[model samples]
Target: MNENQQSMPPETPQTAAAPEAAAAVSVVALPWYRRPLFWGILLFLGLLLLAGWLFWKEWQQAEATKASVAAQTEQWREHNAALESFMQQLRALLAKDPCEVKQGLGRITSPAGVMWPPLASGADRSDAVPQKPGDLADKSGSGRSDTPPAPAQNNADAQKQIPPVPVQKQTPRNVSELMEQATVLVLAMKEEGLAMGTGFFVAPGYVVTNAHVVGDATEAVVVNKAMGRPFAATVRLVAHDNGQDFALLGVDGTSGIVPLKLAQSVSRTERVSAWGFPGAVTNDDPKFAALLKGDEAAAPEVVYTEGVVSVILERNPPLIVHTATVSQGNSGGPLINEKGDVVGINTFIKLDDASYRQSSLAIVCSSLAAFLRGAGVSITMAQASESAGGKQ
Candidate 1:
């Protein structure tokens, strides 16, 4: 029995050692890197690190590309804005005409003297009935023959002596209609800026304005208030009388404006209006681009002031004084009566003070008539001869 117990104890010790042998065998079976779970975890950690690095690089590259595109877009916008501004300046330069500017007036002078007539009320205010366009039947009828007349030397001579009447005489229109038709804007460039003034059609292709308004320019430009392209003009005739402060200018082309009829006389109580480009409304030198900023600018316009004749002066050539408001640019405008007849040329203003208190003066019809006659312009006023007789 003692031997059997000893043998069983030995078997118990072997059983305990067997578990340690198995553990050692398992540890020695694979190295740390060769184990299946160890290798799988290492590979997964490596892949995660690689993916994080790639994502960070892609994010940095995208940020750089976005910054470069933004810089290029801003530069292109600046270049486009600069190109548009240059085009506007080029268009304004091309619109100016070469013949619009002139150098001198060359050998033009005023008449010896003008007549200063006493005030007279001879202007006819009767409404002018419209005349039809046709040849008037000859009251004499002496040249008529039943048979056809042969072309002869005597007939040609007789026909030359007697001139045929035109189809239509001047059709007189209302003063309001004439104002819209005849008024013109005169512009002349000087050292300071453009000298703007008022003028009107006196004949088909002729205009009358002030001497100072025209200055010594040989060419002037006329723009109608009725909205048309400016007409380039040559100063065909210029008559200046310092005493009268008047000038007669003949434009190159007919403005197609209705001419106002000249009145032989103007009464002291006549209601009148002075039409012109007053300095109050017109700028001597306007800066359009700067003044308007980015907004579009429009063309300048004229102004009119209404008043009445207060007194007629007793000077050498009588001046018609009025209460019509006048300004620096109103020098060459016409003093038109209620009937729309041109009585005088607006010349100068006498200021009571530096304030708005002022009295305006215009050259009377007698002086204007004398000036027109000296220039060989024949006017058909019913009482022009009688008005001249009063001046003497």
Candidate 2:
């Protein structure tokens, strides 16, 4: 009975915590490498971090390299430009400076004075001039009481002698020559902004853009694509004619400007080329185009439009009419002919939307220039105005 009761029960039973520990010790734990999910996660995280860092570093390096290249290129360009300018000066020194252009001696002597530009377009003095009389006084000096009769041969010879009329090119022709001597410019203003119309070299150190472009400009910016630097400019001449729907503005101090040649007036049915900063063709502001704004710029810069004279009208002023279609910015631009001479001033147009066309309108430039001269502020006009100067 005592053995049954004792029953090894008291054989020291294990504690709860102790039994759990013994069971865990019997189970085998899985190795981290053999747990495929764990290993894959680790690998993926490592790759993501490494790739990100590499990309960042590469970006930084590329940017640095680009900056370096740009700087080097700019330096080279500037150096080359300076060298070329110096060479030009040296050549001029070797040759003759126009500033040093003399009048007579060795083709260098100074002449009397500046000659006034002769009549430009309208008036012709060919037949109105008086002829010089030769030896009439000598013939009369025979001291005859009734003046001895001249021999028929002498009279006939005297009658045959004629005075020569001065042959000089008019204003339009000379205006082009002056322009050919000018430099290029990018026009702008203050109250407004960039100039509205296109401009070209009208005379040396001068540019001919539209008057309205520089009309409100307290200031202007001049740039020659060939030169690549901006310069200050002022309006020198203004041939503003709204009725004619054209104006001429002159920029002073630009050299080597190429003045477009002008042709005498012509009727409708003539073929002509229209040139301007239409903002629909080429772009003067290339930077804008590069900035993804190329589309908005329909017409900018210098562009040409060629078409036949759609119509010629003197509705107001004698105008060259055509279907060449012009934009607003075309005002004061040159309407050139096959000969490359300016035939008109790109001035106005009436839209023909139905035809998807534009009616070309231009002021016969030769006539307008003449009219401007006629209404000009000449010395004589100034004097007269002063004499009759009334306060407006």
Q: Which ten residues in a row have the lowest lDDT in candidate 1?
A: 129-138
Off by over 4 Å in 2: 1-186, 190-192, 237-242, 245-248, 282-301, 371-392
- In order of appearance, the predictions have TM-scores of 0.49, 0.43
lDDT of 1 by residue, 1-392 (tens): 78777776444677679988988878646678778999899889999999999999999999999999999898777666655544333233223221111121111121223111100111210111001101011112332223344445755475468643321223435656567557766665433234557787766666778766766666666655342334545555555544655567665445355576677787776777888767666653252111111111223455678888888988757888898898766777888776676788887665443353677888886787677777776554535543332231
Clashes of 1: 0
Native-to-model Cα distance after best TM-score fit, residue 351 in candidate 2, in Å:
0.9
Q: RMSD of candidate 2 to the true fold?
A: 26.5
For candidate 2, lDDT tens digit of each residue in 1-392? Answer: 68788775554445547878888899998998899899899999999999999999999999999999999999888777766665444333323311231111123211223111111111222222111112211133222334545777877575457322211232334423323222233345323223345555443444455555455444454443332233345555554443433333433333333455445555556667676656444334563232112121121235556787766666556767766656655656667655555666665555443454556667775665564454441211112222221112
lDDT of each: 0.57, 0.47
The alpha-carbon RMSD values of the candidates against the true structure, listed in the order shown, are 19.0, 26.5
